[model samples]
Target: MTIRDVATRAGVSPATVSRVFSQPETVAPGTRQRVLTAAEELRYAPNPVARSLARRRTGNLGIVVPDIANSFSAMIIKAAQQEARHAEYALFVTASEELVDDEERQARALAPQVDGLLLTSPQASDACLRELADIVPVVVTNRLLDSVPAVLTESAQATGHAVEHLHALGHREVAYLAGPDGYSNQSRTSGLQAACARLGLEPVVLGPFPARFSSGVRAADLVLAAGVTAVVAFNDDIAAGLLTRFADRGVRVPEQISVVGHDDTALAEMVTPRLTTVHIPAAAAGATATQLLIRYVRGDDSGVRRYELPSELIVRGSTGPVTARST
Candidate 1:
């Protein structure tokens, strides 16, 4: 039976019935028992998880990611869970596997079950994202939206610094191995272009490879073909892949080719030659997005808000002064 039917039998408003199932602590003991008894007699299952988005304090939040397998995404998810726990709110997380359509579908399914949503590295178009914001409170990270609130890394300047580091070491030409053509890729591209123009260095761009270690391994052959002394990877996963392939081909890092990575994840250090990378504050961004989402849920503010966290390049053994370029 529907919520209204249960409410009528319990002699209470539909909202009260919802609160009884979703937030029983708010209901009087006697009233809660009466509602429970009625639901039992009617054989009604509230399916609380799916119905948690009722118009009351449901104490639940939702989060969506482009790809859950990515280490950067994992870091954000873990941090968000901690923040949600501290706030005494439950979090529901799902991924789109980097598909824009699947991301939209999953988000739409989740919208009705939580008080607010945290979106990380969303691949959805602006129109789709705006539509979702109209349906539920939305806070995004790793991307900037014209209308929706966003928390992102301001990395263009830092990206320039990465290029400058190469230039300082006497490398006049650099290549970039990219991931998807999403907003993140665009941001890096903008930074690279600006840096090259300002420093008068030549820049070469390689494939928009999948953001995976295997993909990077495949891209390693292409990097050697580009004939640049240095290369910047989209992320640490791909950066590690490049190292693996370069080693197999007998291409010594720094001495033959220098490499830079983004999102300085744990893999940066685990590799043979430590990677020089751009550090994105994933944990802080997750916590901050969660805080904003809850604030919106509690009616603190409904207007759009924005946050741009900093990114820095970490130098390591992966890069060095220009050496003889490996053929």
Candidate 2:
């Protein structure tokens, strides 16, 4: 029931029991094992609040995402939670509703209660993030800010490959359905532009649309108006919505308009024709970010600031050779 009880059963002093629980590596392995065994038998568990107050650590990590409902964010959160648990840390997660102000507010609020923070695709400005980092150890995913540790996926490379694929299939012009304004969206746009120039293809830049299914539905008209043979969407949710609109309008995919999407989310496969998309390692990014945060929180200063994950293009049923249109 208490450290004293555990120590009595393990035939050790109370200080030894405390050392075994607080810094097990400092205690002898045999002694540590005996203390643990006795503690288990006696049903003795350290009080987290008392330990936190004594050590000045909450034993909790904070995570903030733009949208908890998004599949991409969900994957990241789940993996991060698993990694935190493995490191014996609890996670406090918050959603920012895709707003920069909300993200900053959440970070400020969580900074006092958690040992560190993990921010996934944060929309907050660099100044805001830098200030937040000053208040607490922060690890970022999907955004690159100076002096902040980050885990970034290769968005530009994936977009370039998608463009190459479309070009090979004789798509002379492609319309890009843009996502919300952020570092990730900026990277995707840059990739699309670079690829278009490299491939000698015309690029039709569309809306700074919300990364939602409804936006995709609305984008269908703009896409058709652009007269591009192929369309590259910001993410799978938008791509799925476009597919629905195309189907309703009797426009055959691949035959009339080939489509490509990013983030290879579950919606990519759930659509009638599986989407050709760029696969971003959401889970890996999350796990890696958690590890980096844990390391930083523990005062491991190896000057490791960034971890870049690769993204790949996946060909599926949604895209094919461009067809000739009747004038």
Candidate 3:
């Protein structure tokens, strides 16, 4: 049914229902509750386009991610939604599936309807990102660009922590499952290498995986061949994949080859042997990016700012002291 139908039943005007959805505090709490109950009973809903036109805003924020299926991105979306709700805004999340073209198209589709955009692991080039920012307020998370604002980037720091954790476990040799060669992943690789040198450990760089589970399978062979005692995966999916592949190959985790993943995704804990990983705050990143974008939208002359949230090394069953036999 329509909003007007529910309005008639609730004895309130259509505007009251609209305000109840968009700006609830403006309506009396009792009246608001009555309208909501009436609308639910009648299954009434308002037209988004009409509401958007009237408000001069879609009352929404756009979020573009390389892949929504990826736990990191999924967590960020959850956080962005919560943050948006706290800010009295709605969120429209989109997945680009790790394609530059798809990301650009999604951004275009979302720009007209939303007040601003929050991008995670953005695939677009700096020039393209600059252009996109001109169209709307854009706050990027995970990836860094010279001209754009970024939040929750922990490539160097987190990678270093992972290496140090493995080192503490008596792993003098570790393999890093690299992601596709991009600014973000490259930074991570570089950081891990630096940490390796500092810890006096040998670092082996493996496949620049497509940041997917299948890539983890491919990486397992490389790890087996290199004879590294531990593997630091670029993300939780790759780490989980490596763990699964290792199991399929009859290689035991922490018994033979220890594994560590980044992102501390839900899958990390759900696995049989809970993954040892770096806990990156993807949700916090989403929330902070929303705050920053809103600040920029409100003309906060905040200088181009960068925030690097803290990441922790989670000691779990997947990682243990290097087997003396491997050494």
Candidate 4:
């Protein structure tokens, strides 16, 4: 139960046992194996806090998300936790509640306590994030910046495909139910714009709405007023909200209006008339970010400054050919 007992049983000095636990790469392969075997036999485990205090490496990774309750963030965190555990590390997570000042404060505070940090869909500006990176090893997911290492889903191509799909369904005019201004909003918006231009479809920009269900509900009237035949929401949260509002108003989806969403979250399926959305690889992005940060913390550069996962447009029940009512 004690490291000292395990060290004695392994026929190795206590210092060597400590080194094996903290910096196994520094120990010989056979010696490391012996120490591990002895520890396993004795049911011995190094105390995380004590070991961290001695070695200055907490063996922990910190992650910050904008909304902890959001399904996308939940999936990413779960994946990050699994990947961290696989590397013999643990995860500490906190939410920023979508406030810029709170995000920066929480991230800065969490930096010193962990070996590295993973930021998911950060709300802070790039310059501020760069300052944080200067203090600790950081891996960012769902956003991209040249100054900071990042992993994100490359949504532009698939978003373009979604636009094409809408256009093919005879939806000439489409409104975008937007999210709050951030790198993610910029990316999704630009991708959609470029696609509309290529297809010669009229694109109406409807909102700079929050990434919340309420925003989607409020935006429904605006979307209806725009008189567009179809709508592309920023994410599933907004899309689901739109669904609820449309149902309450007796607006038949796909007949009166077709709706498309991004980040194919569980809500995509749970809503009445399942959402047609672009499938973002949230779990893959999370795992990759965790792996990259842990490697960076180990002083190993895998040479990946940025990583992008693929996406696809998943056609579902929410979209269809435009009806005469839309016209």
Candidate 5:
């Protein structure tokens, strides 16, 4: 059903229905109730595209991410959804699956239907990002953009700090289990490399890993053979995988090999040997990005501002001083 149909059933003009959304105070309370009741009974979901064309406001925010399965992405989506609802807006989320073409397609497809777009380290090139910003306001999360504002969680820097933590545990060799090839992965790799360089330690960068349990399972052997006392993973999923794989291999955690992961997701502390990881402020970043996009939509040029949130290391049972001998 359409809003027009709802309007007819409510015996009100389409304008009145629109007013019920944008300016409910302008409509009589009785009439607003009728329209709402009709809309609910009819299951009428508004055509956001039509609304955008008519009012120049979609009342929606488009969120594009590389992978929805990532816990970090899930947290951001949750927070952004809450902030959007609180501001009387809607949230639309799409995934790119780490494909540049798919990222571009999702961005273009959702742009016109949303008042603004939030990208989580989009795979598109700088030129593509610039074009996207030209078409609509874009807020990049955990990614850098020259033409658009961004809310960054400093994942790279956090990764660096994680390395330092591992190094302080007397680990001379450290390995990184990385996510897929994207701007975010590059940042993490660079951060690890920088930290390793400063410590005069060798950094073993492995796999554009799938950022999943199975991928971590596959990476276990490589991690064990690398002779690294501590291994930092792409995220909590991989860290959990690492811990499970090590257990299956009869290698005790921390005592045999220290493991660390990024994104202090709920799963981080749930396992037997709780994961040590970098805590990305995913929720706060999401809420802040939504607020910035809303301001931009409201004609506040000041919304075009970069906000950098802090990240911290959450040390857990998974990491410790280097073991004297392999388990």
Candidate 6:
């Protein structure tokens, strides 16, 4: 029914009913319980849109991802949705399909409709992200900008761990199947480079390839052509693709050449030779980013700029010691 109906049934004023729903902490416990019971009995539900308009808040949050179809993005979305529900805020999610132009458009469109925005692995440039933040509160993930608060996975550090693991396995020469240009890719590539340098190993950097399974299939030939003892792929999907391609070409993984991948997605284990990978905490990153955005929406202006999550390297069947021919 309505707040008035509930107030009448509860023998309380309309203001008290409103306070019980919106500012419950200010309402007395007995009065709060009475209002809640009456509202439940009357099946009364407040109009969120009207409340938002009056309060100058939408009670809605927005999240934008590069590719919602990707497993990594899917995990983030799932976790973020749960967090938003727990906070009693509605989530409006959009996928930019890995296009920077689409990402910018979505950000602009979502800004007016949402209280704040959560950008996960955004492909948009630093300038565009900052401008969007000017329109609404923004918290980003997988990207670090000067002013924008970000929840970043330690992709770079994890890559270093992957490199060390390969090194320990006696892989002197390795290849990196690179992904498309973005903050995440940049961080990963930097980590690979640093690790290679520290370990006194040489790296054969391959394409700014599409981070897709098909791309991994094509990279299989390139990996063989480069003749490295091991290869690290952009993600598990690509590594799985490589496994299929290598099998087709009669190249045995871990026997002839070892392989590793990033973002230890489920695909890492489903393949014939389980993929060794860097575990990026996709769920944790999503939850943390939502929490940060909510904090900003509530006007908690803490000076925290970045939140970096830890990642680890998981050694699996896909990687092994260098063989005689590989060396």
Q: What CA root-mean-square deviation does each model show from the true structure?
A: 5.8, 3.2, 6.1, 3.0, 5.6, 3.3
| Predictions in order: lDDT | 0.87, 0.90, 0.84, 0.89, 0.85, 0.89
Alpha-carbon shift of residue 193 in model 5 (angstroms): 2.2
Q: Which candidate gets the maximum lDDT versus the true structure? A: 2
lDDT digits (tens) for residues 1-327 of candidate 4: 788898899999999999998888999999999999999998898998887877788888999998888878888999999999999888999999888899999999999989999998887888888988898898898777787789978888888889999999988999987787776778788889999999887799988887888888999988999989899999999998898999999999978899999899988999979999999898898989998998899988758788878889999999999878879
lDDT at 42 for candidate 2? 90
Rank ordering of all candidates by TM-score, starting from the highest: 4, 2, 6, 1, 5, 3
Mark the 10 consecutive residues where model 2 has the least summed lDDT: 318-327
Residues 217-317 of candidate 1: C-alpha lDDT, one tens digit per residue: 99989888878889999888899999999999999998999999999888888998999999988888898999888888888875548888999989999
C-alpha lDDT of residue 174 in model 5: 85
Residue 239 Cα positional deviation in candidate 4, in Å, after optimal superposition? 0.5
- What's each prediction's TM-score? 0.83, 0.88, 0.81, 0.89, 0.82, 0.87
Error of 1 at 15 (Å): 12
The collision pairs in model 4 are: none
Tens-place lDDT digits, model 5, residues 121-160:
7778889899888989888877776678888777777788
Question: Cα deviation in Å at residue 280, candidate 3?
Answer: 0.6
lDDT of 3 by residue, 155-262 (tens): 677778878878887888799888866666876788898998888877888777888888898789889999899899999899988988899999988988889888
Clashing pairs in 2: none
Model 3, residue 105: displacement in angstroms? Answer: 1.9
lDDT of 1: 0.87
lDDT of 6 by residue, 193-272 (tens): 99999999889999888777888998999899987889999888788889999999999988999999888888888898
Worst 10 residues of 6 by lDDT: 47-56
RMSD of 5: 5.6
Global CA lDDT computed for model 4: 0.89
lDDT of 2 at 51: 74
